[model samples]
Target: MKKYILLIFLAAGITMTISCRKYPVDEKGLLITDNTTCYMSSFNLLGSDNQTVLVTIPTFANGLIDTVKGTVTATAKFGTNITKVKPYCSLGANDMLVDPFMGQWTDFTQPKTFTLISGTRKIKKVYTITVTVQQ
Candidate 1:
C-alpha cells in the first residue's frame, strides 16, 4: 500500500507540473494568450538629427513597449535647432494608440502626451514625450 501511495503522489506531481504552464505577457501585464493583444510593438520619432540626437523607447521584460511611461526624449546638438518633431508608432492587432502631437510640425516646443487603446479589452495607456534643445 505504501508503494502504491508513493506512485500516486509522483503521478500527481507530474500532472501539476504539466498543467502549470507560463503564458506570454505584455508590458501592460496582460496575458498574450488567446486574442488579448495590447502593446506598442514599435515607436520612433522621424526627421530628428539621428547623428546628434538620442531617442530611447522604454520596453517591458516581455518585450512589449512600455505605454505608461512611453516617454521619448530627444536632445539636439550644440547650436542645433529642432525645427519639427513627428511621432510614429505601431501597436498590436486591433489595438489603437494615438499621439496628440503626432504629425504636428513644431520646434520641440513642449511636452507631448500619447494614449493607447487596447483592441478588444478597451484598455488605455498613456505616455509623455519631450524634446530638449541643448546649446
Candidate 2:
C-alpha cells in the first residue's frame, strides 16, 4: 500500500511538471518563454533636431495609448512643422516594424496607422495615431 501511494505521488508530480509552460531563468538571469507582448508602449514625435516636439501634458506621456480602442493621440507644440516630423515609438523588446519605418520624415497632416506584431509573430494589432497641432 505504501509503495502504491509513493508511485501515485510521483506520477502526479510528473504530470504537474509537464503541464506547466513557464520556463525558468537562463544563464543571463532572464526568464525564458515565448514573448507574447503586442502593443505600443510609448509614442513620440521628433523634429529635425531629433528631439520631441510634442507638447507634454504633464511633463511626460508624449502620446496616449488606448488599448481598448487601438488608438494613439498626441498634441504637437504650437508652430511645430507637422508636415515633416518623424515618429518614434517603443514596442515589445523583440518586436519588428518595417515598411513605413520610424525616424524618417513623415507628414502628420493626417492620421497614420501602424501595425504592430508580437515577438512570437502570432498576434498583431493595428493602432491609429492622430496628432493635432496646438494653435
Candidate 3:
C-alpha cells in the first residue's frame, strides 16, 4: 500500500514538472531559438562594378576584419573615390547586420560603425570600418 502511494506521487510530480516548460514563440507562433554568433568573417569595399576597390598593385590590399577588436580597416586604390563606395562582407548563417544598411553607397573617407546582430537573442556586435586612399 505504501509503495503504491509513493509511485502515484512520483508520477504526478514528474508530469507537473514536464508540463511546466515553456518555449518562446514568435508572432506567428514559431519557436524562437538562440543562435548567439554575430561577427563578420570578411569585409571589403566595392566599386560601381561590384568589384573590390582596394589597391593590389605591389601587394594585395584586403580589408582587415579583426574579430577581437571588432574593427575593419582597408586602403582604397589611389584613384578610387571614397565617398561613393560600397561594402561587402561574409557573416554567419544566422547573423546579419542591423545598422548602416548594406548593399548601398556609403562614404568611407571617415570611420563608420556597422552593427551586426544574431537571430532570436539579438546579440549585436559593432564593427568600425576605416578606409584611407593610397598615396
Candidate 4:
C-alpha cells in the first residue's frame, strides 16, 4: 500500500511540474520563435455612435531559400466601401511594431512598426486584424 501511494505522489508531482512550465520571452516581452512567422491581432476599436469598421492585414514571405522577408498588406471596409490600405511601421514603447492599419506578422530576426489613418469619422467601429506566420 505504501509503495502504491509513493508512486501516486510521484506522478502527481510530475504532472504539476509539467503543467506549470513557462516559456521564455524575449527582451521586448514578446514570445520568440526561430524560423517561424508570428501573428498578432487587436481588439475591435469602437466609435461613439455604433458603426463598425473591419480591418485585416496579411504578411507575406518570399525570398531566397533560407532567407526570410516580410511585407504588410491590409484592407479596410467601412460599412460598405472596401478600401485597400497600407500602414507604415512605427516604433512603439516596447519596440514592437504598432501598425494600426491591420494585423502584424514578424519573424524573430527584427522588430517592426505600423501606423494607419481612418479616412473618416466613425460613430461606431470595429477592426479585425489577422497575422499569419509562414514556415
Candidate 1 structure quality by residue, lDDT tens digits, 1-135: 999999999999999998997766667675544445556666555565443233354334433355455655545445544566555666666435454635555556677667765544456667665666665
Each candidate structure's TM-score, on Cα atoms with residue i matched to residue i, is: 0.48, 0.67, 0.67, 0.32
Q: Of the candidates numbered 2 and 4, which has the greater TM-score value?
A: 2
Which structure is stronger by lDDT: 2 or 3?
2
Candidate 1: stretches off by over 4 Å:
1-36, 48-70, 77-80, 99-101
10 residues in a row with least lDDT, candidate 4: 61-70
- Candidate 1's TM-score reads 0.48
Worst 10 residues of 1 by lDDT: 50-59
**Model 2 vs. true fold: TM:** 0.67
Model 2: which residue pairs collide?
none
Instruction: Give residue 57's error in model 4 in angstroms.
Output: 8.2
Q: Counting only residues 3 or more apart in sequence or on different chains, how many pairs clash (N, Cα, C under 3 Å) in candidate 4?
A: 10
Residue clash pairs of candidate 4: 49-123, 50-124, 51-124, 89-113, 89-114, 90-113, 90-114, 97-112, 98-114, 99-114
Q: How does candidate 3 score on lDDT?
A: 0.74
lDDT against the true structure, each candidate:
0.57, 0.76, 0.74, 0.33
Q: What is the descending lDDT order?
A: 2, 3, 1, 4
With candidate 2 superimposed using the best TM-score fit, by how many Å does residue 89's alpha carbon deviate from the native?
Answer: 0.6
